[model samples]
Target chain A: MAQVLSLHAAERRQLAAWACDAYPHEACGLMLGVSEADGVRVLEVRRARNLNVERARDRYDIDPADYLAAEREATARGCELVGVWHTHPDHPARPSPTDLALAWPGWSYVIAAVTAAGMTELRAWRLNGGHQFDEESIEEADPS
Target chain B: MSHIVIRIPTPLRGHTAGADEVPVEARSVGEALARLGELHPGILERVLDGDGQPRQFVNIFLGSGNVRALDGMNTPVRDGDVLAIIPAVAGGGHESGGCKTESPSGTDYRA
Candidate 1:
């Protein structure tokens, strides 16, 4: 069965906000959550500084130190660092070949597309049995 | 040999049988990684390449500091110290601005 990405509506707004705030440049972040039986349930979304200044418009390099800090934060919350996310300024929210080449098999990869009008779409992907990305379903978390 | 704590990143956790932290005994980072590979079948190659160097995408950290800034994999480990594996998160579009980026080989989503 395909894996799903479960996220809260408010968190989805946070993704949009980050993407829009970054505007012309790419915005990057990490998602922390528990790996559920069917998919991932993201509990937090933390900003990751994009260290690629030369090609800020289309490129993103998440700060490794930020990842370490986020991992420790996730651990403290009994969650794990489950995924990496970034914005595609005006590009489509799909995994580019470079994205696929760097991606690992189990973690979710979320891509949000932001334009002058703001975030237009958000998508999730995961490596499949073929070692290639197959779009994963996004399940809106139930408000409790 | 030092008894140390090695924190597994989310992506590599599968190779560690879902164990977030593995207790390993070794005197140096290299030995600790070797022990990890022995206990977890697929992790060594994923973390390190044929040159015995960390794969381009993987980073090994001692506490909050990156090992690359330390002594590479030869960095010595002390008992009760902590290590972490963090894969680089990097990807960009065509530097050409007019063309999609060329990887060694893969579909150019922009095309």
Candidate 2:
């Protein structure tokens, strides 16, 4: 059976806004409180430098210290870092090669693509051990 | 011409009228994207900059590899090549202190 991973409508809107806000430069951040029973919950969002200065692409580092702190906080809250997300400017929201190599097995990778027309496209994926991508769908609900 | 698949995200599905994936053909990534633009009309600006280069936050993958390490949008694709686009996700708590020491580059956390 295929497992479905999704984001709340409010969270989806927030992520879309972030993707557009961090335009031109790739935005990097993490998702917190991912639970199988509760589904994926998006927590904090952070924007980081691409670090790939030469190519000006979307490479990221979560400030090792900050990353550890996030892990500890999640553990304390009995949550898991179940998913990771990023932005794609002017491209469809999908997983890239670096995304595949960087993605950890069992984690959901989310990508948000921002368009020149000021639109945001969000998609999710899972990386197989063979480094192949399995596309996941996002079911959106009316934002109340 | 080989067909390349462009996967659409939910948020942007309105642009494709909720179509999850669209197929296009071109010799290079740019041409393929141009084909995508022809079908989608105004999506190119969203994925590319005024200079015709991919935006900084967006990452393009040709098959299982990142185009950045390759020739970027110029990377060649044959029939059945799957191109995946990934955007950046940000947001998290910052460390107050103690954990501020920078580690050497290239350290794998899981190793």
Candidate 3:
């Protein structure tokens, strides 16, 4: 039900670090948080292993095992897996066709456009019916 | 009949009335899912293809065992079993580390 993505400052910083640390390879992760009436509040950003070794530079596949662990962690902390975040090494902070193909409804997606110059942009999105993405606004919020 | 719990992922929670976990009674994975479809209308279409097979982008797990690695839809279920449906989270750029694309693109709206 969340149409927007709100990130705690620390989580945002962590995502940024993940983007840069992965460098030329695409970085993938899970966002754990609570869903609010207006937006999804991201309390934590967990970097998951990208299993797409063959396409490491241009693609990412979050390991299912990591996803299982993330879901358990979220449950233990009384939160939900509200979103997924990834970096497009040198690409724009936008959803690709493959992104749409693998996306699920009711989850926010955050993309960071990273380059040798560092992260240039961070954008949020949600997939709706008809296999399309609707951009969502990102906000910096205080932790609960 | 076994009383099973299906762990609904966030993406499917909308169709599940926002309930993360739902209980059902069934004897096999297929029956459990069929009951879930009846309990949550819009979910089945997303999880299954027209041919009734699991969607390529969706993964179903009976506890820690992936159904695909087991008996799939025919996998037996026991009381207190947990079935989890997780969407495959994936995406990528071009091989050059830049997301070069030539296909007709989907609309990209800015908020």
Candidate with best lDDT:
1
Candidate 2: lDDT of A121? 71
Tens-digit lDDT string for candidate 1 (A7-104): 99999999999999999999998999989899999998899999889889988889999999999999898999889899888889998766776676
Deviation from native of the Cα of residue B47 in model 1, angstroms:
0.8
* Higher-ranked by TM-score: 1 or 3: 1
Order of the predicted models by lDDT, top scorer first: 1, 3, 2
Which of the predicted structures, 2 or 3, would earn the higher lDDT when compared with the native? 3
Per DockQ, the best of the predicted structures is 1
Local distance difference test scores for all models: 0.85, 0.58, 0.84
Query: After superposition, which runs of candidate 2 have C-alpha atoms over 4 Å from their true positions?
Result: A37-56, A141-144, B1-111
Quick one: best TM-score, which candidate?
1
lDDT of 3 by residue, B11-49 (tens): 778788889999999999999999999998978987887
Clashing residue pairs for model 1: none
RMSD of 2: 17.4
The TM-scores that each candidate's chain B achieves against the reference are: 0.81, 0.76, 0.83
**Relative to the true interface, what fraction of contacts does candidate 2 keep?**
0.01
Q: Lowest-lDDT window of 10 residues in candidate 2 chain A?
A: A61-70
